[model samples]
Target: MGTHVIKMPDIGEGIAEVELSQWHVQVGDLVVEDQVLADVMTDKAMVDIPSPVHGKVIALGGQPGEVMAVGSILISIEVEGAGNVREGSEAPPAKPAPAPVSEKPVEVAVVEPVAKPAAVPAPAPTRAAPVARQPDERPLASPAVRKRAWDAGIELRFVHGSGPAGRILHDDLDAYLAQAEQPAQNVSSRYARRTDEEQIPVIGLRRKIAQRMQDATRRAAHFSYVEEVDVTALEELRVHLNHQHGDSRGKLTLLPFLVRALVVALRDFPQINVRYDDEAQVITRHGAVHVGVAAQTDGGLMVPVLRHAESLDLWSSADEINRLAKAARSGKATREEMSGSTITLTSLGALGGIVSTPVLNLPEVAIVGVNRIVERPVVIKGQIVVRKMMNLSSSFDHRVVDGMDAAQFIQAIRGLLEQPACLFVE
Candidate 1:
């Protein structure tokens, strides 16, 4: 057997170093070709590093939360054929793969605690309800299997294993899920004292979010303005369009109309659609309106850009928004899809309260925050009537945008939404 050393690849745009978010395989674990070995975090997204050849994991170069440079050895695998490893290069590989870093985390699992078959006849084939193991035994499975079990809040200890050496496979998990009965909640559990603690390291995409939010707050002079808009007409128009063409075209959401309003309103307030580079002391007013739509995923918040919003119609715009949102949530959004926006739009949907002050997406001077719509009495022509009203809580960089311009910009959006017909008019 020979060692096949895999190096940390250079994920584009001249990134020198990246954070090792998590390792899918550890030493002595058998892995197959195309199996994901680790997940690396760049500025915008999480990238999976896959194995080139089927092998047993022999060594790990870095641990979770470590910042590794590009081209450095990532992991070493033991394969059947002559690997890419050169003669007398084994010693140097050990230097980069520190003894303490690689071996520590695994000790709590199979390496030192329960199972220690070096060429591991691992347990998890797919994972179901734990079965046929001691109380302290750790179940074996692939990273993907573990993730699925984790998301469902299922404990592997009770799961039955049917694979080689009693490894839990997907079939076992499916059987368990299909056949297992839900346990009843214990009455005394509510009052029981709890001592469980979880340590989530601020690494990967989370770390980037923290750094960017801090920088934006420290560097930019942020001020927010709140305005109320009567959206009864906009909702009617959206429903009408969907009722007429939803089967052939697609269903329409309030998001598409809001995006259209921004597109139409920006024609009057071009200054709001810009990126300001503070270090270079330059303000770039882009002709193209690239809007960043914020989406929440299991990992964290991601803003996938809607490129060239000025060009697409309402249906096309909705399709693009849905597509981008899906990609971002599924961890499939590319770097280009995640970057370069002149402005941002954030909405909390039904959870959007009366008002909120959102932080500006850095370099972009403006962000529009949408609130929940509620019907309330309004005095029109000295008569009290119920109308659907919502608030627009928007923020701007006070350094470049004057108070008057910011107010006027939101007012323009309000007029378009209130009228709804003006959005399509040239």
Candidate 2:
């Protein structure tokens, strides 16, 4: 029996350390070559550490959320014949104690010293249901308790109160709910006092997201500007184009149109298409428009960059967005696909409300957030008319972009969207 040790591989790009996100094969589990043993998270991407030789895992070098240096021993495996690690040339990490295996959680309690009780049987006390009040009488409950009762469609007046002076309390409401007979859903089950909790270690992409978000907020002076855009003409154009080219190409979405508008709008606002380097005290303006589209995935929010928005047309940009979004969600997006953006665009689709203050993607000075489009009444010339309206809630690094410049930049996008033809015009 010999031991083979696997060290954390360098993820490259000057990354010194990475977080041990997860372990697929625990101690004593046999693994095959090319089988993923663990997952490590870099600042930009999740890299899978795979097994090179078939063996049984003997030790785990680190726990989840531990930042391990490159070339550090990751896992030790027992292999057939003489393994690469010979007779402890270097000391391996101490094997972690195995967790207690159980089907259900056990609570620890201190034994109390007490006198023996008498052999007398105790009878259960019977309490009648609280008398239901008249429908005209309002139940005395705090606003929060009343809100809960109101949300549950339970008239507090009909619910019996056990509080002093018949004032209803949250626990009283819980008791009433527990006693009530419900057929569709067992509402009483929700009244149970829960002592169970799960502790999820913040690791992988979630930790990276938290770090970047905190860094962005801490390093950059952020300010937000909101503007409403009338997209009646743009939506009509999108629908018409989709109708004509739906079979040949693909269905048109608002994303492609927004990208087109941003690309066009950036021509006049080159200052907004620049990355600010805080340490270097310098800003580099790029002619190319690399738009990072924020995608919500199973792991966390990832921004997959669209290489050059200027080069790709509407459908091409849409295709790339869909592809990158899929890759991000599936944890297949490359580091290149996730980085090097001059600006970012974020939207919550149907979930997007009237306004949202978005965080700036670090290094990039601006992030444009799209809100849901709604048909609202607006006066065109003299009379009130219904029009498709959307709001752009964008944030900028105040140190790099002035308030006036940010406002004008959003106004430019609004103009390009309102006049859809100008997005294609030079």
Candidate 3:
């Protein structure tokens, strides 16, 4: 009989491969069309792959937690009526009884790992109670919810669900926390005994973010130079412009203005807008500017690019940046918008950081870091007065961009911000 092979399908853009995070089917199991076969983690997000045809699984191509490329064979299936067959191999031997067409296919149960035997045996009286829900009778839940429960150290069996088919929701986490109660001590006593130390396991998105940052730092040659800029006039102009425009729905943020300033700065310092050719030992400068705004998502760090950023007006830039950032945060950014960035801009003001040295996006020569603009008392005209100020830090690849060029590029940006009128000049 004929056998069918299922190959992995495209899950995302520019992502040729993904890590198989979970496998739902195994050898000798019956699967149907649209049934989830596995979950794969792409660069942007995690997606569940479904079976394309009905069949009994024969073998899997890769193990869970292993990365596999797109279009690679994922599983081999034995089609109904057409038994398992191999190329140039002998036919299957006849069974003792003919296989019934109407009879349900028997599933070959997967053997789970057996833990080591306990040191002591339990009492016979308490040994037997009642069997819990069988696998088929149990309610269905999304793999993400199950993973969250597992990570929170909560038993799935004990949690109540509020989703379709009785699936668990994130709100159920509160009940889990309530079930996990503390006892046997007063708060004062517990606090007295508590040492000023805590241990947290790094897992999920935070863990992945940490790993990627470590990788970026380890692989790229990063050189950062910080310059403090007086943005008092810029901030005042922004406020006045916003009031005059009166676009309540689309209030201008410091970012779009910053992006506009950067575009102008790059017009003069194009080297800062180029990508480094690590292999060819050359820097390829782009005629157009595609600026990526680094956004923090629930999954991890995602940088969404605005194509032809230099050609857009300040309002259009603000609108698109707003849309792209929103999309990235919602995990709906398209692949094209997530890739092909010649440079990037990172902001940590919402989190309240004064200054930071951001790591370079590989293949890209530089990244600009935006910090908080606060009112700090300073000596202006030999008198102490509250003035709005911010620090801008630009990190560049020393292999491609010289220190003088980097410094001047950053200074040009500062000059534009301080002048506020040069950004609009021809």
Candidate 4:
């Protein structure tokens, strides 16, 4: 018998180490090639590590939650039989066949049927044996689709693939779900609900976000200021812009204009763009503006920073934001896209909240909250008129920014929005 060591393989990008989540085999247990031996978790996804050869497991390096680097030895296995040293490759030795049973005559039948001088039969011609069946090979779906199937408790293998080359697609899953007449698959039991709630351990991206949010809250003395702005004129400009240049020109969302207005305001008041150095008791006032747009994702919250926002025009800023948001939603966002944000903006326009107190993005002095815009009655030149109004609420680190400074910053943005011509000024 010979021993073979198994090492961890690279599973995801920017992942230096992984948490050993689970082990499926134990010592002395025989495992086969391609059998899943353990589950490892990186920052992005959980991947199963399979055995490459047939062998009996001899030792485990560590338990679950223990961080292991890539290429680190995970398990040791002992190969069986001579020259079958390839771990987890050879089939387990077959058990010995049971011995044959014998029967005899009831009465004294005597003599073993008189030793018939038996003639040896001619040797039978030999034939070759049939080959063993090979393992199944089907086209795999995208990892995102696979994850969705797992979340919905659906088996991808059983689903009829209708995608290219018989590969499973998201639409295929949707079609199956639409036509399925099986009993309702309840995600959780209503009657079995416990009075005591079970706590789910937050790991991966969610954990990282939680840590940063907590630090932001604890370190910054936040004060929120809210004001309602009449965006009818801005909306009119957007509609005109869209009419001139169709959707192909760009998705003329109000965010770009808002970002532009913020940029202009920051140029005038650079102190508001500063990050507080809590330990050094100093503030880093950046000359160049980098704005982080918080995008909600299936995995958790991800903020993709728009670098050098001060230098980019409104159209360019809109295009970059659109591309980054798409990437974030598709789980294709990179580490660089997520870090080095000097400021952040979060919009709950869809949820329709009138006002909200946005927590400061740590070390950074501010976060801007955009609330839903709806029609409201306002007196215009002594005549009550219906207009689209939205609340712009900004939370700032009070230690660095006073209430007057915060109000002035919002006022400057309001001025730019009120007079859209100001955005064109250098």
Candidate 5:
């Protein structure tokens, strides 16, 4: 038999390590070539690693949630047939495998003390004198319950155990703590109760987001600009288009119109479609516009890129945006779909407030935010009329894009949105 060690492949650019999310195969299971062995998470995307050779799995590297470095031994396999097997190519000595993945939390068994029967003759003499009571021994509780009691500085003996077999439970400790903090008689104080705090481990995508936002805030000088656009004409055109092609093509949204307008405006101002290289002290202006749509999912904020947005027509852009947004919210977007964006667009839908200052997606120079649209009285041609108005809040990296250029670029978008026909023009 020939033993082969498979290492973790580089999943994406600059990804040094990945968290092992799950394993499909276990030790001693036979696996085929090109078969998925495990799934690892990196760059906020799940990547499945396939086996290289058909063999019986000999070992697994680590458990789920463990971070494994790239090029490290991920799994070992033993294959049949060894015509050219190297000398001393024997499998390493086997060690006991880890506990099965289905095992529950670690449990420490508690041994209850057994009472022995006393002699009948001695029992009568013991009643002649009363024995002194002894202090309570350590309480019977689980490790977690004990830790909670310790953290709260409450003795388990003082708290009543309500669990099965008189074991102390977490709720018992909480009740005891609460009762002890109540005011005595008529004296009341606001700071009498102790405050409990929870600690959540910052890991996975959340940790990456925190790090990236902190780095951007420290390095980039952010300048925000807000402008109001009258989108009544655009909304009218959208309603008409949806009515005409609602069944044949998908219903249109304001996003696709905004995307096309931004694409057009980018042509006039290419500086906004650029990425900054801090280490190299250089800026790269991209000709192709890959717009990242900031989508909020149950997991967190995910930005899925619409590649070559500048080349796609209005309908095609709308379709692709729908597809990408669905994939991102459902946690099915690929690494490529989530990366390589020149700029970004964020919208809060109906929940969007009057205005918001969106943070810049790192390395990119600009981000456009769409706020809630409201109908309000306005003076058009010296007459009071209600118009559908929406605010466009945008942020730019001051070091790369000047304040004047940012304002002009947004104004250009406003002009297209107000006209509603220029977006469809060539």
Candidate 6:
């Protein structure tokens, strides 16, 4: 018999550590080679770690939500044959050999002892004693409720538990946050005076976003430009196209038209399709157009790229966009699908306002934002007309793209959108 230790392998992109999102097998569970064991999440993507050898799991290294370093011992397994035992060869003399086939399974603790709850302060003589909790007992709350409280900087302990047996519910956390946001005078009148403030730890995807935004703000000089486009003709063309091929093909969205227009504009202005090398201090231009579409998922914002978008037609572009967006929202997009974009496009659909200054996705030179389209009266050819007007809000890295080039690129898109037929003029 031999025992093998499985170490965390380098998942992708030179990532050093990953958050253990879930565990599929527990200790003492017999697993086979290539069987999935756990799901780990990095900043770029979520990856499933597979078992390397067919064996019985003896121990697990960590629990879910714990950050594990690469090359660290992930889990140990006891295999049948005395083949190559790479990690643990010096077996203890107490258990000279493996247990017989008829023996019961070993019972080892699977949960790690890393994420212990914070120590509670002693209650004052005037107040009742706090509820006793086991050392390993975790706070009883759903993952969504915990995430909401974490995002709102509310501690779970301070939140009054309304669920059965002192469980925290989503409504309880919401009510606590809503009350906390009220005026100090109102809060004092409604509840007892409190002097403590909750401190929430920033981790996971939110931490990555915060760090990247800080880097972008410090490294790049952002300049925003907003222009209103008359999309009445474009909308008419879109509706006609959807009606003609909506059943056979995918439903056409404004994004494909916008993407086509951007491709044309990029051909005219190649400077926007460039990436910056801060260390080398150079801008590298690419011939291929890999456009990224910013998608808001339950986890956070994810940008899934549409590779070689310049070669795809309106229908193909719309199909790929829908597929990528759905994958991102469902947390199923691969790393390749989420990376390697030269520029990005973000839209809020019907929720888009009149104007918004979007932040530049780092290393990329520009980002395009789509605003809500509203119909209003306007003058066209010296005649009163009711037109659908939408605003295009774009931000550029001032260090790379000049103001004139930015204005001209957006103008090119505006012209194409206004004359809808020009978008198909190869």
lDDT of 4 at 224: 97
Global Cα lDDT for candidate 1: 0.88
Q: Which numbered prediction scores highest in TM-score against the true structure? A: 2
Task: Show pairs that collide, candidate 5.
Answer: none
lDDT of the candidates, in the order given: 0.88, 0.89, 0.77, 0.78, 0.84, 0.84
Worst 10 residues of 4 by lDDT: 125-134
Candidate 3 per-residue lDDT, tens place, 56-147, comes to: 87777777656778887777777766443566774433112223366677788999999998787343231222234566676456788778
Candidate 2: where are CA atoms >4 Å away?
A: 94-199
Tens digits of per-residue lDDT for model 4, 1-426: 777677778764667888777678777689999999987655533467899879888777667657888877788777665433365674333222233345763576556656778897565333233223225764468999988888988877667666555667787787667657544444336545457778876754566567778988888898999988998999899899888885677758888888888899998788899878889998888987889898888867777889889888778998999899888777566656766788888887678499899988877898888998899999999999999898998999999999998999998988888788888898
lDDT of 2 at 208: 95
Query: lDDT of candidate 4?
Result: 0.78
Which 10-residue span in candidate 6 carries the lowest summed lDDT? Answer: 91-100
lDDT of 1 by residue, 238-265 (tens): 8899999999999998988888899989
Q: Relative to the unseen true structure, what is the C-alpha lDDT of residue 33 in candidate 3, on a scale of 0 to 100?
A: 91
Ranking by TM-score: 2, 1, 5, 6, 3, 4
Models 1 onward score TM values of 0.75, 0.80, 0.65, 0.60, 0.72, 0.72
Model 4's TM-score against the true structure = 0.60
Model 5 regions lying over 4 Å from their true place? 12-15, 25-32, 53-58, 78-98, 101-199
Query: Better model by lDDT, 3 or 4?
Result: 4
Most lDDT-accurate candidate: 2
